[model samples]
Target: MADRFHEGLRSQVAFVTHTRDYRSAEVLPSLARHGFTTTERPHDRETERLLAQFDPDLVVLAIDPRHDDDIALVRQVARACKAQIIVVAPGPHPHGLALALEAGADVCVRDTDGGEMFNAQLGAILRRKTSPIEQEAEDDGPSTITVRDLVLDFDRCQAVRNGESIPLTPTEFKILAYLAKNAGKVVSPVEILRAVQDYTYSEREAQEIVKVYIRRIRRKVELDPAEPSYIVNVRGFGYMLERRSNRRDAVRASEAA
Candidate 1:
């Protein structure tokens, strides 16, 4: 019965990674047992052509975050196709996970989670993609949210600030749009993950992931990221976005006082 169930999924999965040992010894075997058709590559060389040929249901990326180019690889795969992405990193690195997700990865998995958990995560994502409700949601076209001069264009998955275009990954835009929709309110990291990522993490883990993305967002949006006037931290509570016009005015007022 289990074999039949696995066969029914008929999932086409691919792994793009430089770390071949872990993937070959563990992940690929597990995927095989689950009846998924699989492919593997050491890097994104000729990735577009291969991706188009495979037309996979999911793409797994195993990378070391310290290599700056790994993040770029994720962005490249994201632009290449609509396949859901899962990034597998070596260990418990929250910042790495945040970077992967922000670069358009659908989910980030730590390799320490082992093959069983990895297989389970992939299976869950496949189920969600095949879900009827999820399909309906994807059918809806993009929309826009205007928060003063910060305009979030969901169609293009980018932001425009005072007529200047700022490119953002889909996940980054979601986090920002969530904060904008609830402007002037403090939003906890856990709340943001639940609403945007559709998953829950421990408060500590969520904080680590959300803070990195917030810092990145500030760099792109704030005139002086070091002393931000737009997104403000609420101390031990959470973060809030101040929706006042001309945020520089607030900075000047504080400096004058």
Candidate 2:
């Protein structure tokens, strides 16, 4: 495919993968047409140095989720650069995509996606970086929200409980934040999924996917994962993050029991 040169883009891209030959020919040329300068590195110790030198506007990591260290690599890259990231997982592991996003990638795309689709993802990232609306939203909102003893810092993608930091993946944090933002209301799994992932799914599928992440969040935030007080499941409905008043009532009920 011919590279389409979009003027004024000039974004520098850094691509990192386990091997030098995994779709570089396709990815580099596709990005080039978008007026992005490209650099490639193998996923190794040297990659961080290359990233430091390249100073890219975006970083693309090609990874398989099965490798235990892949998530670590994502964290390493995230710590190494402030660049927006795109993760290309080469197969049908939706869970892997979740983990990649949780680790800090701005977006995750499948290897099977066509060049145009890939470029579109890049364009979206660029737009988000420069969009006036996004800037305005960032400027206008309170960057943190407090829920019970937990404090969520939106600017940092971090959560704290009782003066200690609670470790949460980006997706997990997003789910928790969404729930906190709508505390006391029952939220359907589809609503949680759309709020966190910005994608729609069948209700059943959304339930299963959201269930797993909610369970994971509970383990991190709840005093008892088995009997979650903050994230309460509404039978036949969905889940709710208990409001402070509800939490006190639950506490009183527990004390009486």
Candidate 3:
């Protein structure tokens, strides 16, 4: 049964399992059926070796509670590898999921529904992996906008302000990058909703979600989030990037004068 499922997977995947019985009985056959390559490793050392060797695009971690510090293991693996991870656990716990997220598990699934839900979740993750946002700027060109000492590198998915890197979630980063790319332009909420979520503006409920994400982004990138200097709300319209500078820039300008 597992073998049949494994052969059908459209994307390349790497499976990691520590338990020998589970690996042989369940994991290997399923992975083979889904057309995913399986790499069985004992524990720490071999797991690390295989991860580096395979350099998998996605990692499916089958974790059991009895194993030695599974959470920590997951954390170590996630930190070391750039691949997106989907963790399968015995049961759902809010605290556990929170810990998993901190450890870098992009998605988590409970084993209650058996392997069926696991397979579905795996497929969903793969679908998302296939489509990534196309950057709106040139790779080597100067950024389209600079706001509050921050340089928006749309092509590279990076934001640097005063030599410090500000981490933004994929959605937050995209929203900011898009606004910055079209700087000095008052982009409407409708336009923002379409660009960021790829949803039609007519769905007002979905568009409202954009505001929530924008507020979260502002907290991270703005100096005074209450009076946002980087992402400015244009009253009834939407948002705009404000041009400001760090104190260091001001001091340097004064010295030059």
Global lDDT of each candidate: 0.71, 0.70, 0.59
- Candidate 3 or 2, higher TM-score: 2
| Each prediction's RMSD to truth | 6.3, 6.6, 10.5
For model 2, the superposed segments whose C-alpha errors exceed 4 Å read: 1-13, 18-26, 29-37, 52-57, 67-72, 75-84, 95-106, 116-144, 151-173, 188-190, 201-228, 232-239, 245-257
Model 2 lDDT tens row, 125-206? 5543333334445564577888788888877778998998987755677789898888778789889877665556567656
Q: How does each model score on TM-score? A: 0.63, 0.60, 0.50
Per-prediction backbone clash count: 0, 0, 7
TM-score attained by model 1 = 0.63
For candidate 1, the lDDT comes to 0.71
lDDT of 3 by residue, 84-123 (tens): 6766665545445445544556555556545665665555
Q: Candidate 3: lDDT of 110?
A: 56
Q: Which sequence of candidate numbers ranks them by lDDT, best first?
A: 1, 2, 3
User: By TM-score, how accurate is candidate 2?
Assistant: 0.60
Off by over 4 Å in 1: 1-15, 23-38, 44-59, 66-85, 95-106, 112-142, 246-257
Summing lDDT over every window of 10 consecutive residues in candidate 3, give the lowest-scoring window. 248-257
The candidate that achieves the highest lDDT relative to the unseen native structure: 1
